[model samples]
Target: MPFVKTTWRNSISFKVLLAYVAGVGLSILLIALGAVALITSRSDILLTTDVAERTHELAGKLMFDVAGHPTGFDDSEGDRVWTFKSLGVEIGYRVLDSQANVVLASTDEAFWSPVAKSPPSDQGRFKFEREGMLMYAATAPVERDGTIWYLQFAVSERLMELLHQGFAWPFMGAGIVLFSLVLLFVFGACAYFTLGYALKPLREVSESAAAISPRSLHSRLDSKTVPSEVAPLVSSFNSALERLEQGYRVQQEFLATAAHELKTPLALIRAQIELMAPDKTRDSLLNDVEHMTRQVQQLLLLAETSEAHNYSFAAVNVGEVVQQAADYLQRMADAARVGIVLTGHTATQTPWQADRSALFTLLKNLLENAIQHAPEGTQVRVQCTADKLTVRDWGSGVEQAQLPHIFTRFWRGAHRRDHGAGLGLTICQEIARAHGWTLVAHRAEPGLAFCLSPPVTDSPSMNSSQESS
Candidate 1:
């Protein structure tokens, strides 16, 4: 089955959207927590302070009764007549001496306790619990004729409970409403900023990628529009596009060269056959025809490497493949008076996952090119490791200036000694690319050395040994 290809639109946009949503959601959550904490703390402090202040004021007013007259502190007439109302609840006051006694009391006995002890002179406020009821009182000292008097104000448990019930819900409700509105605003703001700034660069990248085509593979997204977090990705993509554009140009040139090379051989063969005579030279003519056919076949192989879908991958034995390619080119090497040698130590039975036919074609082309370039009586060495194949010849090596164009189609060296097509190295490079391998040519001791490494695979230990002899 063919490999399933994934596209940028299907992957990148969804990922960006997901990130934006996550950022907005997290911001809203944090804002809601902060708002809840702030609102609850402020409400508690305000309610507590307000209640304390009211209790203090009520205690202050009752102190004047004790100072005005000595008999005013009496339970029948003094500060006992005064009442304090706040937040729809009424409170009453009284005055007492140091002893466990009531100098005066309010209208309701439950509100003012006869047994309630007087507070210390320095005490400002106190709480009393009786009959499962809670009461609040604030005590203040009153200066009389010669002794100190205590003015105490008390409020009923029911009134305090009513005040709490009234204040709690509204404050809580306001806090909740405020928190909700704040969350809404935060979410909206995050969505706007995330989409506007964060996602804007990604959208521009998408548009730039969409504008790129095979014909314009050199086009790249503007680096300024890329976010710092995504800069590496953009840089790597542009680098890949540059490599692809170069590969495409090379393939186009290779196709044109292959077409020209094939036409020459076909034209020669046609001309020779068309002018053939039924004579004793038929055998020699047939040999020439076979030679021409071989050349045409080699040209076809080179053309196939440049084409898009000319190779496939399968399990292949590296040892046997190298030997087969060597055997096929052995006669040609002998004819050129070049010695071809193959040597390495690896498992001959081990198999690799690669395109077998393309591998052979690649090896054959490299060997033929090496033999052709090498001088007479030179040795062309072919070595194979499980992961790499190397071919070296003992002839004048390529010059530094010509090295760059060694793999370029139809690029011939300055010291050319033969009239042959120069698509051999170009075809080898293309096949290496299709298999995701590397093919490099460099100067050896006396001649050129071409090397091809196996493509990198997920399983590193699959074939780590050499296989050449």
Candidate 2:
């Protein structure tokens, strides 16, 4: 029952099917009731008509016998009554005088009830109960020697009930069974096919939507083939996709244009600032200028990385890339008072096919970011393995909740920013993605660790190209 209730609540198709079945079943039940009542009423009317005719016939016979015998049962009449009783005909008869007393009866033991009072003159038939038995009676008036006698004939109520039940019960049972069978056959097929046909448009809409992606934003949902009820939703979704694509294109264009437009002026400003006298103020101004310059460079890199430019892949040694990145950041590491260590190096480390410049940029960003974030006098260890490299630092690690947001562009956590643009990790992520590699950050006990692994390639290939600075 609970399962049925839940299904009815959650499933529209189930509810629809149930509604149809319930309505049809209820209709069949009411129709069967009406049919049974009509049949029973008609049968009772016919039985009453037969009782009236039999009562009159028996009255005539009884009057003729009484006229010959004067006051008692005749031998021929008695024999006829015994024959009917032997046949199991359960018929009772009595003759009443003008005073309503039973003067004569067919039964010797007084099975026939005496008339308690005079019946209404218009009442030719009536029903009554006596002792534990129900009975139906038909009456007629007869003249015998100038005295009026009431002749009464009765039939058993139990017999009448048996006749009605015997006919009505089987007919009703068969009707219900036939209705259930027909309902199952007709309703099952209609529900299955109707629901399938109705949901086909929704299924098509889902498949079409699933096939769309960033590369295929131009695709639109086909409203023509969908149902009228769902076409509005598909139209709205297509409109939303159009707006999103336009907004994305506009953002990409703005980033590219702004970076290109700001590069030369920011560079010239830096060169001019460097020629000034050396002082604390000068140093502060120079630091700010350098920060701005780095931001612009990062912005340009972000724009380039986001585009659909084809990057050249090549065979590059992971150890060589790590060493180069660490060496290049030696000055920055020294400035931060952090030491860079290289370990786990061995011969026969397989060189995988990847973009050399992209790998360098990736390693450089990771190493620099770790060094910048690590405490002074702490070491950033660069560990190399068969197909992966990890840079571990000893500093306050990122909060567990902030880990996911670290890879997003320009996102900063609860850490000090020393002229950091917050794009370093994001850039590394993009480079790794472009080269078909994966970069993941982990919360090392002392600090954070970043791991890089190149995706497996089928063959060894070598090529070289410079990355945009």
- Candidate No. with top TM-score: 2
Show model 1 residue runs off by greater than 4 Å: 1-269, 272-300, 345-347, 415-417, 456-469
lDDT value, residue 99 of candidate 2? 64
The deviation in Å at residue 338 for candidate 2 is 3.8
Model 2 vs. true fold: TM: 0.57
| TM-scores, all models, native as reference | 0.45, 0.57
Local accuracy of candidate 1 as per-residue lDDT tens digits, 1-469? 1234468567555566566667756766776676556544544344344455765554445434435532433234443343443321346665667663556655456655433443446546666665555556566666656767676666655665456556755576577677666656776577656657776887778777876655357678777867888889988899999999899878767755775677677767767776878665866676666655555555666666655455556667777888888899889888888888888724555466667887888888888888888888878888877677789988888887788899987676654445456667777887776665778988886888987776566321123221210
Candidate 1 backbone clash number:
2
Error of 2 at 221 (Å): 3.3
Q: Write the per-residue lDDT of candidate 2 for residues 147-198, one digit (tens) a residue.
A: 7777777877666566557775677778787877788778778886888789
What is candidate 2's CA lDDT for residue 20? Answer: 79
Give the Å shift of residue 379 in candidate 1.
0.6
